[model samples]
Target: MARIVVIGSGMGAMASAARLAVAGHRVAVYERAATYGGALGRFERDGFVFDTGPGLLHLPAVYRDLFVKTGKEPLERCVALTPVDPASRHLFDDGTDVSLPNASRAQVVSALDAALGVGAGERWGDFLNRARDAWDRTRRPLLEEPLRPDWQVLGRDPYPSVRRRRVLRRDQWAATVGEIGAWELADPRLAALLESYALAYGLDPRSAPAAAAVLPYMEQTFGSWYVRGGMRELARALYERCLARKVEFAFGAEVVAVTEKDGRAAGVELSDGTVVEADSVVFGADPRALAGMTSGRQAWAPGDVEPGPVPPGRFTVFLALRGGRPDGTVHRTVVHSPDAGAEASAAFRGEHSGRPTITVLRPDDPVTRPDDAHEAVTLTATVAAHGPVDWTDEALVARYADGMAAAALPAVPDLRERLLWREVRTPADTAAATGAAGGAVPPPALAGAEGRHLHTANTTRLPGLLLAGGWAHPGGGLAHAGMSGALVAGLVVEGDGFRGSQ
Candidate 1:
């Protein structure tokens, strides 16, 4: 059996390790932090618990498949997976509020029409239909399959554009999400709804390709889910599954360098001055970290190019409220910013917009609070990465957090009165914990933009080294990272010639 060494205990690393272990390989994982689940973190204080990472999971099938393939028990039997109905409630700037039905296009259309206007629902439905086409065209090549040698085909946008007559001008093809919203949706509220999807992932819809419309489509189609305890629980279950498969883990073991022998990866050197040799290596850390370790070696496979600047990280505020969650409250709510263009510019281009879009998550799960009298409210916003904005400045961080909290007041009435202690997590904290440069949170790989958005391939130029995390192909997001693990395992176990995950 090959002695496989995996770097970092992120979701993708653990997933790959578990699958490889099940495949009869001896897998060992080295994590820089003392815990697993890179970004899926939980913050607890005085019996109140808040998920610091993604509050909800979109496209849970990724994890379900992982559990089914790696163990005897299915995911549901292992973890309490519950569907979040009325998936999300949106509060637009114009006081237009709407709750979208989970995974039901007809219901969503009806609700939008009722809330926004007569034609609003129809326009949204049409946009979704176009997004569905994009999903169908690129889902396989961009997601399910491995990065091909001639990936330029993916550079060509697969989002089908509708032809419209223009006076004294050529018909413009929609390329960016913003263009799609402006050209097709027309309504400011509808445009905001579409752009919110991109912003939530730290993507700049203004520059993000029209394929980004698939973001909302995937969520609306697959539905959103939540774990009972917290998102952290999902990480716990995966870690447990890896242990069950006999994968060994060395926590607090920082991988300092990727050692090589005869021009191939030999193993990894830890910060503690110990070396663990392996037949193959799978990295689940940031690509920048990997580059530093290998002295900038292009572990990229043929036709793979270096990724552009990493996207921004998330800035979060965890609130321990004094009152219990009221009955019949949606799990997620988005408070649209007064100015979306300015918000996007600030986040993506560091334009410094004062009013940023904020997402508030209030889960009624018992595990989050100390008792029935308390509730945990998490407020998050996509911010510029650490360096340019200086997330390390305590005063600046506190001010930003306060601004976000104020923005969420519309959702949580009496927020200041129900006040309990509050905690702020900055991008600096993410960098310190996950080792992501500038605490940049990479967005999931998407098609279009001349393939500039796609991540580096899982298989590297080095014979025995591979990538298996958000930083790799298929890119970030809970589902995408899981798929990265699956793809890495397929290539390692089945052979480099393996096309994709089946």
Candidate 2:
């Protein structure tokens, strides 16, 4: 049995530690922060609570598989998950409103048709049909399996674009999500709706590949879920699972350097110069930082997926309201921007824009409120990271937060009247919390656009060092992180021959 040292306590690293422990490898985790979860966090005030990270879970099977492999207790027994019915409510700028049901394609299609027009649902349904085709084509190589060295084929677009003729342009297939919306969907409202999916993941639809359809396809097909107590509870469950597997943890122990004696990774050197040796090392952080520690040894090769442009981050406003959550309310609502194109461009370009798109989450679970009389509302938007914007400017933050909150007033009619207090979390907070350089949130790896959407492979050029996290293979998102951990553990236990989870 080899001794494995997992760097960072992000969900991916923790998941790997648990699996490695179950495999009989002595696993130890070192987290720089006092807490285990990376982006998953919580804020509480006056008995009201809010999740600071992802509001919902997509593809829960990832965690379920982790629990089944690591312990006898199933994931359902560990964390109480509630399906978000009417998956989401879309508040378009044109006063068009819609409530899409959870995991029910028929219901969602019907709702879209009823609200938008008779043919709107059919167009959306057809788009999803094509999206599903893309999902099936790339799901394995892009997700379930470990990223391959010669992954050039994955760069070919899996989304079969419908050919359309544009004015003063030759007939062509829609290459990007923006084109798909414009040329195919043909309605500005529908275009905004399509772009919202990409924006939610910090992606720009205009540049994001048509294969990006997989994002919405995965969510709508599998479902959106919420933990009863907040996403933090899910993190707590995984941390506990790791502990149960006898994995040791060291908090406030920052790994300054990765020590190397031979050609392979030897161990990790802590901030205080304490070196802990291990046979294998799992790094759950930016590959650049890992390189800095290993004498500038890079993780990716020439053809491998290298780090692309710096990513955009999330801006969130948490409201502790005086009134209770309304009855029969959709758990998630997206208040669409007045100009989706402008918003997408600004976010991707790392520029500030007024009236950015916002996602409002209001979970009716009593656990989030002080009592039945009070409620908690979280409003979030995709925006430029802390560096581009003046995050330290108090007035700027308040202005942005106010605009986002006001956008949700229609969804929560009594938002202003039911007011208590609101706290804002900028990318600055994300940078401080997750240690991302600019508080940027990496979007999930997508197939197409010349492999530009892919992330660094889990297997590094270094023999014993591996990568796992939102920044690694399969890329960012709760489920992808879990998959990263599984892949890492498989590579560690089964050696270089390991393919992936199954």
Scored by lDDT, the top model is 2
Q: lDDT by residue for model 2 over 143-195, one digit each (tens)?
A: 98889888888899999999876787887878898998988888888888889
- Residue pairs with colliding backbones in model 2 are none
lDDT of 1 at 96: 90
lDDT of 1 by residue, 1-502 (tens): 9999999988888989999999999999999899999999888899989887888999999999999999999999988999999899999888999999999999999999999989999999999999999999999888888888788888988888776567967876888988888889999899999999999987898899988989999999999999999999999999999999999999999899999999889999999889989999999977656767886766664467676796888899999889889999888999999989989888877534598888999987999999999999999899888888888778888788889889998899889999889999888898888888878888988889999898888878888899988988899999999999988889888886788865
lDDT agreement with native, every candidate: 0.89, 0.90
TM-score of 1: 0.98
Give me the runs in candidate 1 sitting further than 4 Å from their true place. 301-303
